[model samples]
Target: MPFIPHTDEDITGMLDVIGVDSIDALFDEIPKELRAKELAGVPSGLSEMEVTQLLQARARIDGEPTCFIGAGAYDHHIPAAVWQITTRGEFYSAYTPYQAEASQGTLQVLYEFQSMMTALTGLDVSNASLYDGASALAEAVLMAVRANRKVKTTRVLMPRSVHPFYRRTVRSIVQHQGIDLVEVDFDTETGQTTLAHCETAGDEPFAALVVPQPNVFGVLEDVNALTDWAQSRDALVIGVVNPVALALLSPPGDWGQNGADIACGEGQPLGMPLASGGPYLGFLCCQQAFIRQLPGRIAGKTEDVDGKVGYTLTLQAREQHIRRSKATSNICTNQGLLVTAATVHMAILGAEGLERVAAACLANTDRLAQQLCEVPGVEPIFEAPAFHERALRLPAPTEDVLAALAEQDILGGFDLGREYPELGCALLVCATERRTDAEIAAYREALASTLAIAEAA
Candidate 1:
């Protein structure tokens, strides 16, 4: 689509209507330093043919290296059918269906997505979607605050071991809103986020406590224990889970069976590509009691006069559109396109297939870790149970190691120094189903060479 389709006459009409002499006059802010000095040096506008070739060439350039990089968005294998169905003109072009009648198809997909998320989390109610995992967690916090029904609680406990980015995001969203983020410590050796660090009182209490199962470090947490700790107070427990890990470990709902209140997580592993960080779906689900407090949309099934089952947007009262400040949450738009993609992916890979994918990820990560241990200067950080990712403390600084690996076209893992400075020279590694045994061996060989070079230097 032409972003600005202005004909000569249309431009003239607009300028005339605005009483402007030339377009440059509109930006006459009297700041030469800020504005480009003489229209800048560049080629004249290209013809359609030239522009197409230039863009195609740029698109073909491979930016990311040939190996691992998954903090949250994984490098899992996406089936061809995903793209085939997602690219359908009808699904691609559809936007928010304000009119329930006109958007039945979209509504139905959302309904199914909600059902699947609910089933996956083992929660009674699931919202259609939220923005992404971070936003979903922020919404979950707000929901917990509202559920308190007492004086708005000032503090919420988040584990230091949770995704550092997610903790930062939660802080950004709630700081201005007058909420204190209490950082709970984790067992350095075990990599478990324990609730013992939090000091709660009857009057001055936590509104909610957010912890990830198989947290950012990839260690499986004793979620039942965490849940029990939170419930002792009236604090709501929010579990930020990786949907794929549910296959190997217990689901959050089962954690709820012990005592969890709400669940929120990134749904990217279900089939969405990393896509350079997103357009990924954030999934949120809660117990039936908290359904009214959940943010975003909910598609419910209803019957028509003729006795046919039809899906329609239900529970509109919790959103900003209806309740404003008093709304359950301000999340206005659910990631419709990404949510549909996740739904399709889930349908294609049923419960059994999901387990297989999870198994592959687990096995690959184990292999990667095993190979890394063989390298002279590398050591696995913790002796904890991880789902499909882990951290390795190397002999040299992580950046130096990363630079060496880049020479071999291996992307390598995220560096832990920026967040966990205590873990001085650790490289966080992730392995998904997409990584093969041969590729892992190559990574091992490359990493070994890099370590040796760094040591010799």
Candidate 2:
């Protein structure tokens, strides 16, 4: 939708209500030198039809390729009904569920979203949602630090296998608070941060250990042993999981001897489409022990004096335009539309259908990996198992190989060298249920030819 700026009369009315004679008076506190004298490089206004045409032309230049990349955002099959229901005004235009007495429908939608996430993570409770996977993870780490009263250590031991973007976001968020992030390297052969890395991290004063399932390289970690290692040190184990894999793998709540303390991950694969980057969903869940420190709002089911079922904003630790020092998190609202879409998608798929989808994703990915690895100079990098995404050692620098693949109209995969310099000439590729056998075969053939040509050159 095109933006509609305020009319002159409306603006004058707002300024009058604010006791300001002119719009320029609004920013009087800012130094004159700091403010722009005039808007620089601002585009001239265009008609709605002209703006639409301009965007469509640019989009055409950004041709759609058969995507095989799943660095974080995934391309998945979203049931049509998911969006058809979510786009309804009741959900699409709903405000924050703050008025406990009124927002029963919105609150119930969140209640269901939380319930599904908790069930998927096997944790006792869940929040409505967070900003995104990265922020959710940063919040999870902060939660562990606050909850770990006995732990004297301010360090957080995380594996290099965690998504690089998420790791950077966590560091940026927590470093200001004096939290130290110690990165653990992967086992060269397995591409996993094995239990042995934990041992090497030693019995430090660490507050939390983040264990990413089917980590950044798409190699599944030995989470049970890793979880036990963190637990043994009296540090909290924060599991960063992939929701789809939770259907096939052991959930974090059942990870080790006692299981992970907190679980969080990206919820894009649930029902969200890869819309360039996103408007994605973030899911955070954990045991009842640390529910108070949960960074976002949560919903609870209750009955009133009339014995009628109801929903309400059970907990909101955010400062709410109030004090920040005592606030658990600054985030005030949930991703309501995205959460609604996920909830509806999950409901339509059910447990059996979700499991089947996961199974298909695994099988399709495995087949693609097998075919690709069969190509000369192409091999799986990790010995550990993977789900939809996996790392492959390429015969040449990943960028060149990907460029060649693009010429064949394939999106190819993520080049690991940019972030993981040690993983020389490696590519992280994913194949969801949306991938057909023909597409996988095409990727394999294109990749093989690309490598052969690059090697010859």
Candidate 3:
């Protein structure tokens, strides 16, 4: 796509067709008070070569590091074919399938994506995809509150063990709708949410509870007990999980009692890359009973008039299908490209391959944690078993230690002190199957040497 300069006459013709006086007039629909006048300090223009040079310089500022950081987004190894086929003109340039019949290929891709997500989460239904994991969990909270027939209250329980960013995102979303997010603390030693915390939460009229499996510290929670407890109180249990971890742990749909009502999580582990924060998508799934409350779009398969197999968009729960006030979510656009990549990734790695990948991740993580803890100043903060990430207490400030490692071009881990103040100097590290033994060794050596330097200073 080459850029073509629009002539004055072309602009005038376009404005005339739209009954607008100028390009600025087209933005009249947006409130003038809310509009930004301009990007302050931005340069007017530059030659293509000059702009390219500027961008290249900016990109060089971030040094390449052997990434051990996995707070949420992971550095998993993506197959070469995954992106090769995904970027093909057909999938790359695709748009929303407004007319399902005409968009059979796109619809089928989404249908397969939804089917894979459902199988992964052990739920009856799954929407195509959501913006990201944080927003997806927020949407799940909304869905649970709306579908809860047992309670009229919007008070929801969120675990402290869940990712801090996710908790904050949920608060921002549901607070305006009269949803009260109650914090449930985790055991300091085990890094797991104790049932005692919820038991003490009292008989408040709550509608939903979020359970994060293998939480931020990577310690697995007691899913069965947590789910059963929420069900006993007539509150819907929403599981915030890792898609890869689901291959090894019990799926949300089999939690306890009647099982969790909704399961949502970051799908980056499935196929998407970190891409420096994200271009990653979220997956949302639920039991059949709450299928109508599922946000975004769902695709269904059927036979057409000619008896040929076909796929079509089905049960759209967005504002486009119904009144805005009654819609499940207004933010309901599927991550079509990322989902296509994910769908292809899943197809390539079937059930057995997925389990093997997950098992390998566990093995690598265990090995890394064991080696790192051998450093004098480092010790595993949590006694419980964690999948791929573990919190370690460092003798020095985590940021200082991380900075030293960064100098050597090794991305150590997440500084947990920022999110978990109680655990000072805590470092949360993870190692996926993508991390080779040599890379793990390098990280260990860097951290040990960095800590030694800090102590000497």
Candidate 4:
């Protein structure tokens, strides 16, 4: 599409038709104090060719560094065909499927995405998609409070081991609604939340308990015991998990005798890239009983009047589709494009292939940790077994070491002290299937050199 600037007459005529004197009048409802007078930092508009060249130069500045940082977003191998099929005109340009007859292809793709998510979590039902992992968890927290009829309190047990960003997101979203997010501390030794921590909440009831598999520290929690305890107390268990790890570890739905009620997490590992903090997909799933409380839209497969199979949006309890007072959530649309890519990625890598990828990631991370631990003044922080990532204590300042590593074009791991001050000078590192032995060795050498430099300084 070519850019066409509207003339003064065009703007004046449109404003007159709308009974507004000026373009700023359109936003008269906004407080003047809250409005920006001008975009002072924005650069002047550039020609198409000039903008293209500028972007190309910026892209060149961002060299492809070997990434070992898997805090939430992961760096995985995406098949060439995943995006190729996803960006086709039919799927790429498609919008919300308001009319089922005209959107069979897009609706069917969503149906397949939901089916795969349910299978991955071992849950009975799955929503289309949410904003991202953090928002999805916020939605799950709200859903748990509404779905748990037995528990009257809106308090939820959130472990400190859950991603710090996710916890903050959940609190910001639910705090206005009288939701109390009680913090449960993790054991310093294992880096996992223990059953004893929940007991500190006393006999008072909580609506839900959030259990993160292979927590932020990359240590697996004792989910079975935690889930069973929550269920015994009439509290729902919400599992925040990694989709890839699900191929090996027990699914959230099978965590305990009754199983978790809800499972939500980032779906980036499935097929999406870490694209500089995303545009990522968030997946939410639950048992059949709580389907009504599930936010976002769901696609269903059914037979048409001609007895032919068809796909259409179903259980759309969002505010846009129904009465505001009765709606389940205000979340408007699903991440359709990301979902398309994920569905295609899962289809290409079936059960066996996914398991192999998971196994390889576990092996690579373990190997990297072992090799790095051989360096002086660096060792595993926690004794518990980990899945894809691990936390290591460093003798020098984590921020300084990471800065030195970045100078050598190696994207080192996350600095834990920023969020976890108790664990001083800790670094969280990961090694996915996409990582090579050579790359892991390079990271080890880079870290050793950085540490040596820090010690000398």
Candidate 5:
């Protein structure tokens, strides 16, 4: 743990052992112009004490807001008890439970986490965790392809309204594997994934269909009908869902009961911080039919020789440690700490409490949407009811309105026009349980004034 700089002798010995003369020779393939002369803007060196103070000072330049800005990563009220419990030394700096016999506590927590995720998603089984929601979805897609071995066409149909990041993540994962990626468009009025478009796209011999519940636009999909449509064609249906929405909305496992193969989503809103976007948990769950295709390690309950109940890693086919390159997925590590935080948060806020949280968030979002609609230039873009997020069309350009709102230290909604040109002046705004009545009023007032200026300009 002590800092010791490598001496000339040490470098010489290492280089000689590797048959290399100089460090620069290691980058023979890198273009000369691309190589930095001296890390141009950075200072060469600083004393340890100076570096510490510099880092502290730089960190003091906080970019975080004191108020609401919930999109994907929310601003929920994390209980102090969560911090108190998760910070315990036994759990805080723990590593993976590779040695099953030695890591009983670690494995037990993971088992509990898996059980909680199963309950949340309404799936029969759940994996320990994945890196994040996007990766989980990518893994699910890969799993579907693997399950549909008889299918000649390796195609996955995703919705255009699925989180743009999730879509990109799926594409990135499948592109190299030679799977066809089909993105279903939205019904312009509902802002929901179009089943008509899916019917058109689903004609091809496809491996699976990926749909999100309370999708990117926050419009809930008809999971039953969608799952039926996919299964009728003998294709796997994967739903990327919001766990909070699942409290009020139908669970994807319910879709599995109606016939879906996989369910996955980012578990951030359950109890993780925005932390400028992550260190969040990725939840993947499914019925026993496709359990073999589940990507991450699974924690299953069992009885020891003493006849006492215990937990251990089970059905771990996707991990590299078990199967190497031929594995279903290569996610070596799960989001353990984040998953533990969520498990604790969920335990404290039981079923009724979780539903109450969801209801409060939905109520706040509805109220905010109604208030914002009063602004002359602002109008709700979709007719369908959303859970805790919505898309609104500004009478003026989104950039102008956002810039004006930002001047008041209010982070406005994400601009949809940036990604979908035909969406015109639409902005995607989200509100959660954390946004107070006063803050919602403030955001409305700010948007009203900002919109007036935008329209005039």
Candidate 6:
């Protein structure tokens, strides 16, 4: 919609109807000292055309840098139809489906999304969606603690190989709830959290073990072993996974003898663009036995009075619907719009199409790693088999090299030193299906030049 400013008369009429002299009067309840006198350093308003031109100019300045940094969020190709259909009046502006009768369209979309997610993860049930991958893992942790009756301890065996941000989020959310997150270190040689590392936690009973397939380092863990080990000790296994990788690798449901109790991860790779860190979607799925403990809402398909097909929210265990103390979670809503896009994206691609995408990503990253390793003083950090991303040790400092790459409008990759200083000068790089052969070659050339310049200095 084009910008339409209200006329002076329109403003006056609204103020009159509200019995307010001016817009400032609406905030009269706020103390004068607390209220800002003005938006300091703010630019003056511009004409619509001028504003559009200004934004376009700024966008041109940034150009579209080739994105190789996929620590969590990825740069996947989003089909044109995905957003075109999603932004329609019905889907874009749809509100919470408090009244199912009025929201069958939205309810149906949610149902399809849940069905697709379950199929991908090989789990029995999936929530509508969560805030993001990190928050979803936090919710998963809380749920594991609540559902695991065999374990008396609230300790969750968290691997250092898991995304560092996810670990921090779990701590911040569950710390006061008396949940203990015990860190499990990864093997330096393979960049994987081994059974030996998990054993370091000792024989003490813990609620759950977080198993990340193709963990933060992009190294595939021995999930079958990890899952079985956790279950033997009566500990639930929580799989932190990549949805795209799930297409090729075994799903969390097929992890081990009994399978992982819960699985969750960022749904950004499905269709979302890395628009400065999202508006991304988080997916949480689990076994049917843990359905009651699942946070967020679930959409269900059913029949109407006439026996016609219908859709509605089946499980709303959030704080809003149930007693606050009895609620499954304080999360009041789901990411409906983002879910709509993801559902459409999956429907467009289907199973075989998604598999091709996953395969392409793996091939591209492998090629990228091989090419980068050819450069002098650049080497693979781990010997483990990886998926779409890999860790590379650089003779040059990661931050400096990345900065130089950025100067050439190439987002090289993530600097591991910032989070994992022990890895010293290591970088994590990714290559999605969208990354072309030329783009990959360009990145290699840029990095080689950057390192040469650094060494000469």
User: For candidate 3, lDDT tens digit of each residue in 376-430?
Assistant: 9799999988888989999999999998888899889999998889999999998
Better candidate number, 2 or 3, judged by lDDT: 3
Worst 10 residues of 5 by lDDT: 62-71
Which residue runs of candidate 6 sit more than 4 Å off their true CA positions?
1-45
> In candidate 3, how many Å is residue 136 off?
0.5
Question: RMSD to the native, candidate 6?
Answer: 2.7
The TM-score obtained by model 5 is 0.88
lDDT by residue (413-433, candidate 1, tens digit) is 999877899888988898899
Sort by TM-score, best first: 6, 4, 2, 3, 1, 5
Which residue runs does candidate 4 get wrong by more than 4 Å? 1-47
Give the higher-lDDT candidate: 2 or 4: 4
> How many pairs collide in each candidate, listed in order?
0, 1, 0, 0, 1, 0
Q: Extract clashing residue pairs from model 2.
A: 153-205
Top-lDDT structure, candidate number:
6
How much lDDT does each candidate structure score?
Answer: 0.83, 0.88, 0.88, 0.92, 0.82, 0.92
Question: What is the C-alpha lDDT profile of model 6 across 131-152, one tens digit per residue?
Answer: 9999999999999999998877
Candidates 4 and 5 compared by TM-score, better number: 4
Compared with the true structure, the alpha-carbon lDDT of candidate 6 equals 0.92
Which residue ranges in model 5 land beyond 4 Å of their true spot?
Answer: 1-56, 63-68, 149-152
Weakest lDDT window of 10 consecutive positions for candidate 6: 314-323
Candidate 2 Cα outliers beyond 4 Å, as residue runs: 1-40, 317-323
TM-score of 1: 0.89
